[model samples]
Target: MVVLSRRIRSEDWKPVGVSELEVNALQVVRSVDNRSVIAGPGAGKTELLAQRAAYLLQTGASPAPRRILAISFKRDAATNLAARVRQRCHRIHAERFDSMTFDAFAKGLIDRFGQALPERWRPRSDYEIMFPGDRDYREFLSRQIGVPPAHIGTYADIQAISVKTFERRHLVGTPLPLDGWLQPTPAQWAAGCYWQRFLHEGKKSFLSFSMIGRLAELLLRVNPMVQDALRLTYSHLFMDEFQDTTPIQYELVRTIFLGANTVTTAVGDNKQQIMRWAMAMDDPFSAFDGDFGATRTPLYNNYRSSPELVRIQHILAQALDVQAVAPVSKTVGTIAGASCAIWDFSTPGVEAAHLAAFVAAEIKAQALSPRDFVLLVRQKASEYATVLEPAFVAAGIPMRNEAGMVGAIMLQDLLVEAVSKLIVNVLRLAMATRAGRHWTTCQEALTALVGIAHDDEIAQAKFANELDAYVVTLKATYPNSPKSKVASRAIVEDILRFVGREKVVAAHPAYGQGGWLDEVLDSVAGHLLASSCNHTEWSSALDVYEGIHAVPLMTIHKSKGLEYHSVIFVGLDDGAWWSFANDQIEATAGFFVAFTRAKQRVVFTYCSHRGARTNIATLYQLLTNAGVKKVKIA
Candidate 1:
């Protein structure tokens, strides 16, 4: 092995911060074999991965010169893991940990080494990216003359077809079946036509995340040198949110290290797998067993919830699976009364007043802030906000619906998040005259990029000088201009131009070269930049942007992997969760995820007699079984 080791200590093995992990977690962390850690809510999955990374790096347990590669489903998740590692280990050892999203990893490989891909499948280096919603796919499906939706399947099914395997063998069945997915000759030819134009364009091919994944797979298959290099570079693979692994993601992982010498640890909870379709497997844990020879380790300590709250979660878990064992709560109760309760309301106004009273009492008695409480719904947080915001307003409580627009465009677009962070960082330095924390922060950011070399002093110095000059140019260009959409777009454009687009895209691989960036630029309006502040001083604006100043409200899907001191599940009645009948398992999983989001308390609020005296009978039964008291709000 080439001489490079960030090993901080000799062979002395013990976890560095956080000693609450049990024997099972410790075993999973230190085990050299492939493992699948499937545990319920708040079982310390992220903490376990961090400790494992620390063990490998500090103890020199892993093969020398190889790095630890962590692939998460979200960018924040990747960043969070990287941050935790940095907190737990030395800087040099932490530098050996590479964390990124699945999309970013795939896109990076293709961007750097796609020349080796097969000629027909290789995308142009200048390929653009597309993020299509149902409306776009609907228009495409409508144009087909005789194919029928049954032949090609729905837009959702068509969207699932991999660009890497769009051949007739994968699409068409022998006799052209009447129903189900991709069986007719017309469907096969039609899909091939779409993907062909999508993949091999004359001017510039259009690539989606799926197209990027397939191309990355093709590149790996064609280039042994690249595959060998990757295998040699990374000996440990830590996959977070493994239950949400999609088909393309699964195949790509298998393509890289199916039978390779890498130690892979996947950590997730099946009860929290609320994401749909493209997730691709019936049981990913079992799939992991068959493919990677992984040992399944289940963690049972409920470190997040109180005993009463865990009991409620257990009731729902039992309803979903008869053999489910309840996780023992490791936390002390914070509330003196019932930790889990249901409130029955006859009117919205009275219900609002009652909640305000309860919140005030709780704040006085327990010293909890508004941020400690969260309002969760099965779906449509914005619609519920229309009915509930008046309550918060009447009480002088600040509440925000996360599903509401962030900027002017898509709710949580990747490009918007990346570009926003970039501008904010640059602005921070632009506002700073000398080199201190600002320069260090910007330098750390540049070094942390996947494409940047931490050891390259010359490149680092050159980029640092460029950043200083860019800061100068930015202030000169704007010079105390009021924040507006036009000004925001121009500022963003100037920053992108000065720092270079390729550099930013390299930092954020999923910020694909497309009209989406232009759309995001258009949406970077004054409201988002200033947000609850009078001007563009960074700290004042970031307070609202980071959810520090308001009460939290969001859908259950968005609330996954998040925790609060108090969680209120709104709309327990049947109408709000009408789609539960379509898929009961998924519904139960969603409810389980929502209930476990509290460390001390969970309040289920229902307007039982407001409209039609409606209730979800199954949910009520579970609540009754869990011994939750129903309090009437008058």
Candidate 2:
């Protein structure tokens, strides 16, 4: 075994505070063997993972030019880890490290081995990977499964079943058993039938995201050269959020480098494995057991939360049947008036109003920014929109919800019309420039660019006459060449000025700072400069920029791997959280995950009645038993 302290300088590799548990985990990372790190919440697992990558690069454990592959369950996680590694390691060696999500890794393998795939799996010339859309495909499945379109549940379910079948390594012609995770419902049976046809149609049709993983597994198994190349390319593999990994994902990793020279590290909290319904395995530790001989390392330190928060997490972990290791916290003193509280309301609407007011009061009292707070719910739906948005508006609080951003960008008619017209005019300008048309006046183009109707001759002539003089001045100041950077800048500035950028920003403060409009303009100008302006590209750019900060509101599932200074977990009634399962394990795990998201304080809200039933007895008992204090809202 190699000791990292001896191999590397103290200044180069720090974070050593004489803790036995952290020492064990760090040793495991520096070792040249397989290891499984069972890191509980707030254990600094991400920092540990980032350090491991740095160690491998700095200590020459992984030679230069040979990469270390770090896989994360989420894109943000991967990106953050890569950034951390770059900051810690030397630039020359840090460039050898690569990080990506599992789906992205699978897609890369598929692209490399597309020609070597079996005929049935081989894609046609125009075949593209389609997402879980395409109503025609779902209708085709409905006909085959002897069900109507409405009864097909969702394309998501079909994709899940298909991925699960491949994970189990079931043969092509085998009937997907109705036992285990798959129930014998009409929808399940339909999914099973659709899974088979989904494979058959892979040649000419689009492949779902799940199919990418299955294909990568197949390609690796059938092509030994690709397997060897991959094994040699990466010297170390570090996977974050290992507990959330599906079985197929584990198998894919195992097939590529299990018996090879590559050392692997899997880090996650088994207690937070709440994604079992999405095909995450019940026992993630089994991935490291037998054949691999992985060393187990546990990290129990709670560095992010107060001592009070750590105590609550310990109690909840015990209730959920997860192995409870009391978190060691250095923050001995709790914040004044920061104790956990459960708020009960007479009505959902009233609850929303109270929540908005409470958040405003907390922000002022703590002198915290709006970004420091997060509102988490079990589900985001019409109820959230109706109750929360108006209440926040009435309270003069800024709030942003992920669903709202997506809807505003994708559904708003005015924004959509403006973006579409911009794309069209950009494309037309590119074509005219390519054809060497020198006499095209900017005034006539701007008239069409604004989407003015050709039949409205009076309005067109009026605008064209006003802008004709301006065009002469613009031509003198800026070159007429399409590819010139100066020309692109002038066009973007003039269009933004004409489109009332100031008015747009002033009207929609929810879009965040002034930079958002600039981002939109830059995206449009980049596309126009490249002569690649299309509706899809332009809409995607708008969607990306529309995600600027307001105040993050998301479901608990989406809130995983995220933390805030103050957290409000709303809609904690029976139907929303516990209704997802008959057994209490999943619900308990979910609540545990939600509770640990708070760094300083947590507020759990529940209504007296949700749609018809009173508050759930089980939930009330769990909270009271866990020692949560009941608080009255003014």
Candidate 3:
């Protein structure tokens, strides 16, 4: 509730190109005292964060020769904030700013201060960090816990349990049960054993993602030099999306900089704390005030949505008993009456079809781009994918579902590996001018290429004979050419064509008419031509592919920290939004987060029945009570 002094020193203050509300937030950010800003959706929190970094440099709040560390929850967010800061701040000041995700920061700290780690925590020279999909680590955990590998759920679940265990350990300074997590269950025992072995094997090899936080905490607690060095290195620390901070992450942050002279600012919206399943605290503000002793400043003005949209959001917040801050809209116009509506359908398929048709119509009528829209589901599964994806495809609307993209990327990798092997074979065959010298290698290459081309033995033989003739033609065509150059370009293309890459990709369930698969193929071909198609390079390409402009279909959880001009919230019924087990606090928070992502318009859809359950009565009551008009369709 305390506001920083607004009086600015004339020399230190400069126009940072923000509105008055944002300016107020930036002033608090630039102040030397620790501060926490509660920023709502589209509140320009990221802009304020960037300006804060710039302000620190321009005003000399962060003295020269010291860096400002800005940490975000995700790598893309960190990279984006860093880019914006560099653009706005002075060249010299921007140069001193380092931005990275929390994991990156922790990993870097451990890498730099490994020698300072405790003997048990110290990593051996052969130590390597294995992630969730690492086969060896999964098998090792399976063996340690006596649970079959199939029962381990997912890498994400394993990671969550690991972090939860570490959080307990950090809280009590030893691994003890603070809650039901300590119950003597088989899973709990496995988790405990897995944590112990993970640390035990750190002297040789270990697998981890959550352990980074624990290791960083240990280094900062035990090694004062490391703390002092970091304190001296960073004059200001800024954390974006602080609500998503796990207990261990916050502990690490507090351990290193709580009492230091470094000015710290944590910006987040408690209402947007929808990542509870990820170990995010339900009440993040208390930690800011009680744990860090930071002053709180709330940024209430919503600059992203129309007045009508803001009104609806306020109603939802009030119903959920969340802090309802009425956002003053900076948007110019009112949304159309139909902009917000609840569509009720008799079946899920009908609902999906109508939704897709509505999107197509909106894009055409309003001159909107497909990228402006998003379809958010409560969960990503076959239930939604089967109904929704075909609907979009039939409607001629482009949609990018993350699950599908993942499949496409996996397929792309397979194709790339096949291409690489084929090229290697072609080059080997070209080098075997005198047959006996490299006959075995040439034969192996030909056999592999033919095997990759067809399943039937007769077809494989035909393809192999054709490939041999084509190689002879290629050699004759480029008699003096370097084998690699010929193989990389011409031969690679021939192999891709012979293997029916396009046909196979087009037949994939993940393939859309938008030619995303074609784009992936083109990218793979480009990489193959450059002779640089490696896992890392292909993975980077996948990241780029995911960023392409298209209508996104994802869960509300995955949709956090992203905004769209129009958001369609599907399955707004009771079972999807409310559960009998809890008070639905987390679900309401998630709903609030999803609704606020809209920039101009929002729509909610629900089926009359979800499997054996009737439609969500509570959701119906809440919407009708809030005066939300409903359109029922059969």
Candidate 4:
């Protein structure tokens, strides 16, 4: 009887092997009156989200407006989902849906409201990049917690600590020092105070990306005009990875298009609520249909992985407070004749070497290329000493990172950051006009000009003297450096090249491909600084990765949305996943996310020798229950 039902039952509606879950979602979404979508893991939530978006797009009036807004928690996921939506819809009436990450969308909103803010916080015509200040926030906190800097387990730990600390101290304007290396000046502290008050009471505050959802909610309630504008802009909103959304995000969703925009659909698994630190509250899966009162739908089919992989995931899900129930228990395809075994080398160099060897074996034995496999680690820092660096070098495999982009035109970011500093410093120095260019050599001049009354007088003077000597060396030996001109450009180039080759290892690719992207970015950067201009371009590390031809060794979190022929989940220990942080209950969601990434073979490696009672044992029990055969625990 409803207009939505009329659209759903149209003759053009042909099922494309949608699981019962998807069908249920389509039916329920049509009658959306604020109900919860309660489903288990591997329930085709993402599929449903895509389908819901496609259905809305296809059935809508011809020549789709950019009314449908879909958002993802991560940039990659957003891109992937958008691709899927574009593919599913018919071209004759293709949907022009707008997509972006929540942070990016929030940044757009902030830019729109920039003029209303204080003068200091006014929007800049140029890029306003989020810069990391002097001291690494996590390193500082590690000292306060009495945890050794080396003892910091993962980047996730660092990020969590940083986010929490930033919220407590910087965002909230609470000036309590954590560990004393990086102290905010009086002015900085005052800025923090102002921001805190602004967030608490001010209608429009300078919000960090983490706090965007909260701000969006505030605007919805406080600014009806913005809400109406949003309604006109986005007739319907479909949020993917709903489980990861924080409480304030949910409130914002409700506040904006509550009555006029009733066609709201959210997709997520209750078992995958992993971002508790960012204030992501209860699982939005059930709340989508229940608390928010949208129609409920269940999607239980597992399409991404083989049955064996699904079984492994289902087994792991048992450890969670909220577990997903598998609809049809099917095993994944066999990685036949492929040698799969798990081994551990405690030391870093040896571990890297071992990983490289394993990758080599996979390439030789299974006919897999380096790009076919990915080596994922917990942190970017881990890639160098522990895994990919040594392994790749030992096996003669090339690798890429920020440094790999060297001399490449793609990496403008690194170039901009590095060259800007150099030019600023050069301008202060006021070096000779090679091309009548003004240079600033502040560090050199300031060292001789002043002295800290309470500090080491002799040593300070000596340091200043040494700095002057270094400047003289630059002027005489490398005049074409940052301080000099076109003639000096050669010297600058040589210094950058030498520094990169010797100390930084070509922070990017050189003239050829797979060298380092950093080089290209820096080269473009220097040119931009000299030219004084801006442009928008983008690139990725796909070349270095594909060329290396190695197996991926990475963390479960990093492994999200990535699949491989064979996935070996290392470090399935309880302590690693449970962590000291309070997000243990939600963290189990990662196990499902990781296990499902394996397309064929799912090999889980556990360190049973290290601990008395291992979480892997529990995982084993779950796997067996889910009908995973040939699962050996070693």
By lDDT rank, best first, the candidates go 1, 3, 2, 4
User: Ten residues in a row with the worst lDDT in model 4?
Assistant: 533-542
Please provide, for model 4 over 582-607, each residue's C-alpha lDDT reduced to its tens digit, 9 standing for 90 to 100. Answer: 45465556656666666666554444
Which run of 10 residues does model 3 get worst, by summed lDDT? 171-180
lDDT of 4: 0.49
* Model 1 lDDT tens row, 375-422: 898877788788777777677676777777755453433222767666
What TM-score fits each model? 0.84, 0.70, 0.69, 0.61
The lDDT leader among the candidates is: 1
TM-score of model 1 vs. true structure: 0.84
Model 3 TM-score, 2 decimals: 0.69
What RMSD does model 4 have?
A: 17.1
Query: Which one is best on TM-score?
Result: 1
Using lDDT as the measure, name the better of candidate 1 and candidate 3: 1
RMSD of each: 5.6, 13.7, 14.8, 17.1
lDDT per residue, candidate 3, 143-205, as tens digits? Answer: 444532454445444444443333333322332332324444334545555655665654454
Candidates' C-alpha lDDT? 0.72, 0.64, 0.65, 0.49
Q: What residue runs in model 1 are displaced by over 4 Å at the alpha carbon? A: 1-10, 133-138, 145-186, 200-204, 407-416, 425-443, 447-481, 490-501, 525-527, 530-538, 608-615
Query: Residue 142 of candidate 3: its Cα lDDT?
Result: 44
